[model samples]
Target: MATWISIEGHRRLVEIIPNEVQELWDKWEIRGLILVSLVSQLILIVLGNRRRYKPNICTRALVWSTYLLADWVAAVAMGAISSNLGEYYENNHKKFSKYYINPQLLAFWAPFFLMHLGGPDTITAYALEDNELWLRHLVGLLSQTALTLYIIIMSWKGNWLSHLTIAMLIVGIIKYAERTWSLYCGSIQHLRDSFLRTIDTSKKIEQQQESNNDGMNFWEFLANSIQKDFENEERRAGDPRNYLRAIYIFVSLFADMVLSPWDITQDRKELHDRGCFHWSTYFTLVNNELKLMYDVFYTKAFANYGIQGLISRLVTLITTIVVLASYCKLSENKEHQVVDQIITYLLLVGALLAELSSFFFAVFSRWTRHYFRLRGSATFCCILGCIIDCFFTKSRVHISMGQSSFFTIICNKSLIIKGNFFPVNKLEKLSSVSHRLTSEHVLQKVYRSLYDKSERSLQSNLSGVPGYRSLLLEKNKPIFASEVEFHRTIITWHIVTDLCYHFYDEPSYHFDPRKNSKEMSDYMFFLLVKQRQMLPVGAGLITLRDTVIEAKRVFEDINVVTQEDNLGEACRKLLERSTTIPRNEDLRMQSTSILLHACDITNELIADAGEYRLPMWDFVEELWVQIISYAGAQCRVDMHAHQLRRGPEFLSHVWLLQAHLGLLDQFQIIPH
Candidate 1:
């Protein structure tokens, strides 16, 4: 009897719960979905702009989730509405007057979903890969539009609400089309093709030949034109217009397009004249330019420019207003339910607010300023600039460099009692810390080094530090200068830098080259361990692991207390070990462990500084600049573009600056 009663109770629950859920879903499904869609739009408009600057993992994840959810919710709502209209039509046989819930209001909701699918103007592609899926978006546009049209046609009552839906549908299509076009235009293939079409190759060749005969080259003439256009006081360096123009000309570099000799010559001359060699000016311009490019590739900045963009905006605004007015007038008729009327009003108000917000972003956009200047609309541009200055204050780019130290990693490992049983690689990653604001002094030194090396070809520039190899050979330290593998060299130098940092007395001045070298060393190690994709393909993992194992063994033998506070003692202990290289050790065998080699380098640097009365930190600092710049120049173009979406990398800035300065192979033609 007890078992039978339990079975009967289970059966009742199974039947009752599902029926209750089904009834609830049937009543509130469409209403719940539409509300979700509205809230998503609000979230996107408020948070979309944050991703460009804030690259924290949590921030990006939140924005990414909302970006995807907004589209999915809008699409699902449309399908739900379509299903409801189909059911009503099949059951009632097109008898609109007898329906309890008006089908026309349901039709009115369909176009709002279409508008939601259009997305906010602040963001279009969440990642660089999203821009390549333009064809998928195009198909979605067609299918969703057809589905919306079918619903509207099924519920046609030839009334004010139906007419309002038509007007809204037109606006919705325009907005959706704009997003599709933005993705298409941002695709690598399309951007390259468009760029090629704009270049008059035949004319360029003719000009080149004629100028060659005149003892001046085509590049010189083009350089003069750039000066005339961009070097004026009103459009001088640091101007957004200059950055826009530079982007227009140099964006092709991102597509891996080989620039002609004339192009490189023209750009190098123009950049130099613009004082791009000044470290502050160079970084600021590059940072601003990449930020604009991010806007172009990932946002609606490209789509909402020029006469076409203006006309679309005007049409969208007019139709949205007209539809809102018509809805208010129709609400007076009492043909729709109070609940449906309220929901419709909420959607309309949301749409209007979204449109106005989009317009505001577009008007103050750098793209808009560029467009107006190009059209000679000085008055409008000036007015917009004043309005922008009044409202928005420019914020500095937050540049944080990742720092990972071998000494820190080794010293901190003792905290974990499991030791070798635990994953040391994970510990290394966790040990890495990031410092806010890369040193301006370091950047200045790097700029000076690169500018000095710009006259050399890419091969010669990256073939070891410019002038340090000969000096090392003179000191009989050839092995340090001629390390077989780049990764080995990085590990060797990083250990040497850590030893010097802890072993030596602190420098008197705050901006000493010693401090700068130490910071750069840590940053490079960070890249080697974490962001190796931005470096050349190599056995960095093997190199890092072997070096770590050797370091652990050394620490164990010495019985060093491996704690963060005892890091200096640990470094000094390592330095006290024998600095002699094994007599018969093969260079290849030496790769097994670089710790002793690093000790030798540290001694040689200190000895050289004392003997030659030269600043050892200068050589160390410049060597790091060469290593980092080589890494930047060697990084794949696609990887560089990919990092832009995440946040600006120092390496990407260096890469762009190298291209402009004719230090990369992309600038194929060497001007005489």
Candidate 2:
């Protein structure tokens, strides 16, 4: 240790008597630090292999990993002096460049980072799976862009590396822009959904309020509220509206589950009554929704730019131009080229980190607004991690699957195998046995239902009111009541379909899992395999079915599509203040249960038909059964209901998305 100097009367310790004598503490000594860094890298790999640490601790492991890797590599050219004294001796003859700065390596790896960002439609995020997590992806991409630009600058003299990096950047920007556009389109769909829901609710409430003033009983009032429609000015007392309503519900979901096979293509025809929106309506919807999404998407950029676009753009442009000029000028200085490289690299790194920080502020602002819950916020964080490669060490990233890497053509042409939801989905042969086991069930229920005669009488009286029709005996009614009966049914097949292996995982969810099966069992597996979510069409068709049911219970006839009236008997078992109940009471967990269950039923049907793993589209047959059941029932009850009401149109669109995504078991083709 060096002695301290004292200026007062106290005895002073001697400093280095001469500048040349201090040379011992220079370049050669740096070797030890470099060696320590190398040792640390090996230690980390060992510990990671031994399963001694967690991947997402957000500290310790991740920090030390990056520091060790970056610094160790940096020690190369830096540690190259002939001796520690040479570092400071001003050796004019030495060119201090390292051969390790290979342009080919940088050229190969930079773009691989970007390819990892595509984000599946089934699950657009990792780190956080929430739909709102896209904001994080945007930020991560931008940061990576800045970092890549810095590396590109350093390697610009290497023409091939420079050109490759530029090409990757262009492709990356285009891909990112496309994903943003897709998400924007989805947001538009969501807005349309909200609008339709509002309109339906408003009209229903208005009619009910009028009924209450007329002194109708509570049952009557509820029924009227459930069924009334405002769009039709020519609804009649005994029209065939109920039949149309049922068929619409059956047809929409059936079509979505079958021929369409994806949620993105849900058609307007599937909505209860909202046909293809007029061109003007479509444009207005797109513009408004896009405007709203953009506000949400670019919120961070806006904040950084003082919440004004013109100012932000001008400032960014001016700043970038100034930076480029400075960089170019600095590059021409031969004496300070090394210094220039380090400064440029530092600036680039700093800017990227700043960009990331800024991205969160914008995303967090929205996360705060929409989720307002811990899980939601956490989801955003997780998604951010998934979209950005920053969380994982370089060794862990799946270079092949990344956004910036060479595009690959993976052919994982297989899907997850599944089975049926319940006994009802068993094959005709097995169903025979299933039915025998339950033969006494129907008779027992019929007589049991009669025991509640008083309730039925009350319901009948309510349904028979002047303007409304009876729920059960409507002019057009259920060809069979089973369509409505499966309302509360549970389906667990969707989860099974997600088991197909992911091919392009760069950083496997588990870094060390040789000894822990539990760790293997439940994990955030970063896979290219598709996860699951609800389709707009499934939700829409279900909505249409529910709307029709609500209509029958509230209004007596389909002719009253636009009439504001009451069916005293038909009422929901329960009502939420806003937002109707879903097909299943999935308060949490996830939404693709129906699709999953459908897959199960198909599997079961296929199993019974022949071999277990065969491509028996028998599941499609069962789907048709359901479609026909609902369609026939709706056609039968046409004269029974009082009103013809419209349902959410977005479900049709979701159905289309499902079809497009290629998990098409629910949708099947039936030839004439």
Candidate 3:
């Protein structure tokens, strides 16, 4: 009798603990999760929308954190709710159960979890790699759908909310499935193969029609319509008026699609010939291209664009609103705690508002305007265009007269200019320098330097000619430069260029090529440190960091002017003060050697460019462009695909642009 009593006491204690925990969890769990889910969705819409405006570390971290946590919180909440519901069911079936039961309430809440699992369309996946896990998401859909259905069926055996629960469950399944399908469709290989298949089908049909047009079959009609549509697409793609269409064509080229080089050149020429649009257009176009890339890789953009998507979205919105209203009615008539009633009402209102906002954003988007062909009203189209333009057009980096690029530098990275971390007068000086450079910048300097080298190469090629027969052949073909070599060369060259500019006191090159070189060098370094995946193979942050540490160490030993006030002074001091020291230290020896090599190259360039009258700045600019182009081309398509997880980089854009312009050496196909 004593043993039996002890066992009974232990069982009661175990049961009591779970009941207490369940009661607490049931009261606060759904309310808290609903609040968090609603807030996360709002944060994503607001903060995520501003990502393009400010591409800094803080914004990126915040967005990434919110994106990850939002999904995690909602999923965890579902599991918790299901566990509590199961516990309640077992207790209610007991002969002397301690827990109070509300099967109807439990049934009503299960569908909300389904909706949470569906997630907001604004964020399907945070990065490109997330899309690659579409199969995993599909698995999640199956498991979660099964769990939700199980909960709904078990809880709503005699519940009035059963129909509403089923309705919501259907809506949730559709949304979650859409996200998974969009991910599969957006994967790079899949997207590319789709285009290839379309091209192949068109070709096959064309051949069939040519062989037997008299027998006008369904295939022939379909082929002719496809051909006609393709022609119309190409026309629109080439037109300057449709920037979005142009982006689509260029993006296809980057995807390894076989676009004619001549056609690309002609289209570019036409755009340039039509207007002075190149300067401002490139910035806007790049932004748009990145936006499209983001949409394709990160969001439910493709899934939510078509007529079918529109209809499905409409149905989802209507059903969700109707179900929410039904729940509100149930709350009003039922006897429930005031706080619980208020919380339920809040979730309903929040869901409705979120859906409404999403609908509005979609309607006003540039993609919608282009797709629906709603251009009948001139005033309406103009207004819509302006609104869409506002989303992309912020403070642009315009190289104009009397403007400060100091802010541009700051925005790109933090800085201490002229011993002042942030100051008004230094900003004024930087602006004046920027403005002067812009007004006086020359393209010929770059052209003449490259042209002279090309002419020499051509002369060497034609050795049989009277002037070239005696020319000596090169010992070997030039090796493709690695990323380390590129970085080391540019940093050393940038320093040497500074020394030359300051030592010679040549004011002419200072404003144009000198400034341009400094900016490009710094930008490349920034890319190396912050965006390593975008760079050519062999470029590592570790290598850059080690180099910088060595540089600082050498500079400290030299002690020239205490802090190396500017680029010119830093270069001058390194060459004059540091080189005078003994080459005992390995780091210092390496630094001195780099300085000497840069000087030697500069001398050779000067000798080779004799009497050509090409400004030194022009030669430097040409060399920089060649270096940039080579690096860009060396990066593979697979590398670009890998960047889906991290986000797009500026260098990738440069690579694509270079390929389009036929600047990349390997991409230079002769128009046969």
Candidate 4:
């Protein structure tokens, strides 16, 4: 053990040492690159896996930068090494060249660059568009493979190191191929095609089974058949391995098919009515299932499946270990530089550790346990599944306040849009408003300005407010006549919700939904102005800019110059001064007072629900959920497609969820 530590310490020190006294050059470029590649692999493996656990902009950007740099650094290293060869050949040809150093080690290192290009399995594509670059990657695979091969042949003679290089080249090609193929499978078109094939095979088998059993009444036969089919599908959905495949089946079947809300409800009627799970358990299960869907569309998960992928990974791991062992054994006769030797060892060790981590992640994965269970391997299933269950239980127990809200917002955001008070103070403050945002008056004054502008259609055309000619609405028509109309409703109700909350007098009446409601409302507005491409066509940003300008002018007139942090206290003081402003006050000030009065009218409307009365927020929460879900479904698929260049937007996921729920009109099956 002492001797081993001494050798390891020597290897560490050699990494920073110069190769030769006469040559002033440190020969550190290749060493620096190898370290960068190793670091990149570790960063991606750790960060990429955590992405699904938290969906924030900062985390997304971190993963995005690391992912792109992984490939870029490795590719650039290859170009550098290739350039070094020209210099290597020139220096060695000089007859009196005592300073010309042999570059066999550099050439030997080329194959590892190909291995780095393979990337970690934790992430293949940062976004949907990355998968579309599979063809370009394929071209890269061929070009880089040839370049590495050429480097090895021209620079190194057939020695023991040459044999090791060949071994590494084989492993590198396999790794690169796996990544390219994974990218192909992750592509939306490829997934859709795979789904079609699975459906066709299932139908053929079902037809054969039905032909063998006959002589029953049509209704009796149909009912029994449907029951059996549902049971089979339910069992499949219950298993982690099959659940993803099952999702693909439904997604492919319904991508362009249409059905109504009632149809979707009826389809899931049996599961809801007779399933063993409660609503919360069912919600957890669906979330897990959708997470798999997210991976299929956005990551290299689909490529990691099947018997072939398992064998390829196993071979790559074994070959990497073999190469490391071979190099150490052969190093006894070689005069290799200390830094170069350390880099080779680091590359090999990094590969071994990365592969091991991936294996552990897979073994304890829900998919692995389900696979074992389906195959009747009770002992393995119980052990691995127990470990996974315990891990998740501990994770849930450690949930912090912020993580709780973050996850809740992600799962529920796609479900609804409600009229909640989204305070501007919580986020960016108006440059014009000197007061902190805790007061109703701050928002009320702004809403009042919007209300007046809305009445005269100044903001209507700005946000593309729907102009319906008829007074009566048709059955099954959208509740909001236009996208702009829905936008106005959102603004109006936001102010109302805030005022009602502030004026309610009872300190004990606070609810979680009401608190969370403001978050959702603010986030939606954030998406509206900032992520407008994800929503329907509108001039929301322009209108919002106009509102900000007018609100700033109002702030200057009121002479209420308070810092943003003090706005809450300012609002409390304002409310205490008078419930009704003086009649001689500016119309804008009166608008603030009138909007507060409107909140009273809203409170009265909800106070009269019959026995078993619902809280005002309960209705508000449900209403917004439906409204947001509707708006999500209303966005164009083209818009969703365009934004795939960035990471998957929450709005796109909601759009897909609406399609799964049969809420979209695009579900009608097209004839061939």
Candidate 5:
């Protein structure tokens, strides 16, 4: 009897609580949702741009959450307002007047929701995939516009406030339309189609010119022109604006559109002649081009260009200001509820502030600078350029590479919990606790390696590895690094790199090739383990898992602790274990464990370095670059485009650089 009574009372309490909550929601739902929507917009405006360079999980999550919720919240608020309008009409239009807030104030709030649907100027799509959903947004635009119009029509008072509502509605629709158009243009199919059209037109012009010209082709003529331009030393000093223009021409390549031989030749000559072949200038050009591409793919920067964008901005600004002023004049009567007036004032002030901020971003944007320069608006471009130099001098690209260590993952104990019997290595690729800045020395070395390979025409080979065999032979190693499977090669090299990194004493060189090699090894391993989708299909995870399981057993026998000082000793002991048995390729391949293979490679590298009297770390560094570039070139084109939405990947930069250098297979030279 006591249990039954208690259960019945508990059920009654559950039933009573929802009734009270429902009653409260019905009263304050519209006001609460509106305020929340406003807060979301403010958050997006402040935090959206940070995702480009600062790709920490916290920032991405907050920005992504706000971006998604900003739309949903505004749509829901509009629905609530529509429902309220329906109720007011159902009650013979007398109920809202009896309520504390006027129905017209509720109707005024609907336009604010429409503006929120437009989103902030900083971000449009969170990922590349979001751009593909333009039709859904178009559908949303029509439905939401209809719903908002219905709300305004039902609650029309034909006063100054009504006129203000109509004006704000116009601004809201314009903003939403711009976002939809941006998505449409940014879509891959549309982008590719536009590029094809441009290419077709250029092809026709080139054919006409070829018939009129001497025996020299269009590319040869362009190359000569570029050589002449290079005579002016001032032009060779890299300009950021040049990269902005290059993006317009080369962005189609990222969309998987083919470039003609003449196009590649012209681009290569321009880049080489302009001193962009140097490491620093090359990376700067690539980084700036990528940032511009990011703006095109994911921001309103593309839509807010040219005369139409300017007119839209002007009209939206004027209309919003006019409406705000009209509302201020109308508010003088003070006959409405205090809460209603306050909400209306907040929406107006928020809209005005958002517009001003958007305008500020637009005027100082790289796109705007490029536009004014093209249009010969020198004064505007010069002034804006000066302001940017003075205030925004920080490098926009984050040049740091993420590092994940296989040894660290194997030794980490926290990854293994009691309930989970899974391998600790498979729990999660250990979070990158550290990052290495892409030093200029490494960049120069990589640039030289790729340039040398391109000159030798080695990049045209579609079989085996690109630069692996030649680099290995230079060290007197008869074995091909590609003898093993690609994934196994990565695992073996990574482990070998780690062992060598710990076993050798720190070199006194100013630019330590050991450190560079270690960073590339860890970064490639990080991609294999964490970002596998960006790489070619392989059993990298399985290879890594099997290798980690074997290493875990070795660590258990050695009773190792994962401290800095003890890591070297642990590596020394592991090396001793592997070297104890004679190296055998059959044994290495038969076993899933790559630790032995890594040991064999390490011994070979040490032996070859001693025999050749060469810096092993130097060869190691170049070999890793070859591996990375191979992966970068072979990676799917769309994957590189997809990664741009996240922080810029070094691999993508390399891929773009290779394409620009005419090193990729995509740039086939068709004979005239």
Candidate 6:
């Protein structure tokens, strides 16, 4: 009779809690949730303190950190309120049962925090490789936060958290093993290959100098040659682009090596993201992906809309707030609560099916890459293949990424591009040649702005029309002294897009056509033009619009600076270094150049209507110019922002200049 009464009270507690739970919010469990939230918030402050900013930090850090900081506090508030329900239950063991979903909500929130933890931000400028320690610590923090929340949530289901401690231990061990495998695949061997090759080239130079019996040492001799080679240098024989290419080769190679481990990661994430999108399309692809495992997928355990996975993470906060409010609304609409249940059941089934499909698809994707591509990242694909083999045959849940031989299936993940071609090893299509042909207007306008007699030099080069092979080889010769500076910015984009979006080509992104790019492309043909000269301009334009839009959207984004006070430093840099666009014509000409390059390459790639037959040098020039204009903008923005105490203040100068250039519309400035 006593136990029955206690169970009845425990059951009744669910009805009483939400209304009265706020009374005892300072209890241990509530305090624990608050501690977790506080810790998560601190992590953001610390990350910011570390100054681990990537090239595109504005979008990744500011946006993601603000969201995490705000939502984390909200999660804590929910936890505190939910924990107060313990007072209503007569049985101590069933104390927190009313708040069964609270910890689950926290788990659902944990992943978003983790996802943003080490996103796209660079720990170092002019470098592509992320520090291993940073990555490991981030992984540890993410995994621990997720596991702790999952344990608390799953505690209510069957107190399974206590037992799964063993499973967690095993997973941890396997993950460590996976990390070791990754380190090997992204070995430093490839990056050093170029350095070794360069050193050997230098060695030959040294030997030639040594055999001369000149009074100079190896260093002196090399310096002399470099100086002598620097003067009146016409047809650069060795790599004029060497210093930059050397740095870029390492940056790209290192980034590539680090990312190679992600082939397996890409496969899993690709499958997972695909599953999320699958929900949009009524889960048809997800269903087809895992139709064989319907029995495992159709389990009653997953009969809840919010599960501890990717999809739930996306919808959890808003959905939870809605449901909590609906608790009050549902009293009046009690009949409709039944409808909510049915709809939830159906949605839960869809989510479960999607997850089940993803895990399974992740399994086969590795095997397919392994058996077919034969570019083995590890043996785990084989193991995963076997596990899937057993599951299909036995009708049981044998889901595991480790069933494969290696941990790298994530690296070859699919992007969501609906293009006609299949996924290639590294998005292998180069920007085609005709793309180099900048706008005709740009060619006409260059001498009119920068120099007069220089036009004769530019026109001669423009008309020379070097063969595609010769010009392509010419690009390997030389560029500006800061080629490393240029390459770093460009490769940084490669890492993020490849790692995050799986390098999906944004075909719909509004780039100007080839005629437009021509204005910019002509700059490449100038006597001043050299190899890999366009990266700075390319990355800059890439994110300029986003920055302008963000600044407009936020009230606080407006940085108040007088000419000498706020905008002076930036104004000086723009003036001195020529980062400025003096007139709208200058911009229009450049925009035309970018369009010309874009159209030319795109046409060559598509053979779309095949109108223009741009020579090869012209083609390469267009591509370089397109990338350069965008990259140059990024490098300039970075340089400006680096000298500031506050970033917005630094960027505020860009706006001032944009106004000067008559690009106020592009910068979106409104009058006070």
All candidates: TM-score: 0.86, 0.24, 0.72, 0.70, 0.89, 0.27
**Residue-level lDDT tens digits of model 2 in 136-242:** 54675576566656555544665443554465455444434434443432332433453344334435665555443344321222223224422354543212232
lDDT of 1 at 665: 63
RMSD of each: 5.9, 25.0, 9.3, 12.4, 5.5, 23.8
Ranking the candidates on lDDT from highest down gives 5, 1, 3, 4, 6, 2
* Candidate 2: stretches off by over 4 Å: 1-307, 330-332, 337-479, 483-672
lDDT scores in order: 0.73, 0.29, 0.53, 0.53, 0.74, 0.29
Best by lDDT: 5
| Winning model by TM-score | 5
lDDT of 1 by residue, 49-79 (tens): 7766636778788788989999999999999
Better of 2 and 4 by TM-score: 4
lDDT of 4 by residue, 225-322 (tens): 33344556445324443343334323453233233333244344433343454333332343454455555555545445433455676787788888
Is 4 or 6 the stronger prediction by lDDT?
4
Q: In model 5, how large is the Cα lDDT of residue 83? A: 82
Residues 1-672 of candidate 6 have per-residue lDDT tens digits of 011123565665333344344434423354444444444434433343233112134644653455355345534544443333334333453655433323332332333222222221111111112222335544554555555454445434443323333333333333233323232222344334534443444446545543642333222323333333334435221222212121222222222222122222222223233333312121122212222111111111111111222243234323333433443443343433353334333322332333344333433432232222122323654565566556643332111100110001111123222322223322222111112222333333321221222223322221123222233345463321112323332232222112111111223123233332333332322211122221233443222222222222221223322122223332223223322223356544433112222212332333422433234324433444334322322333223222221111212222222211222122222223
Distance (Å) between predicted and true CA of 532, model 2?
6.2
- How much is the lDDT of residue 500 in candidate 3? 54
The runs of at least 3 residues in candidate 5 whose Cα sits more than 4 Å from the true structure, single-residue gaps closed, are 1-14, 17-20, 93-99, 204-241, 276-278, 393-397, 415-432, 456-464, 473-482, 507-511, 581-591, 611-614
- What TM-score would candidate 6 get against the native? 0.27
Residue 649 lDDT, candidate 1, scale 0-100: 77
RMSD of 2: 25.0
Those runs of model 6 whose alpha carbons end farther than 4 Å from true positions after fitting are: 1-252, 255-672
Which model, 4 or 5, shows the larger lDDT?
Answer: 5
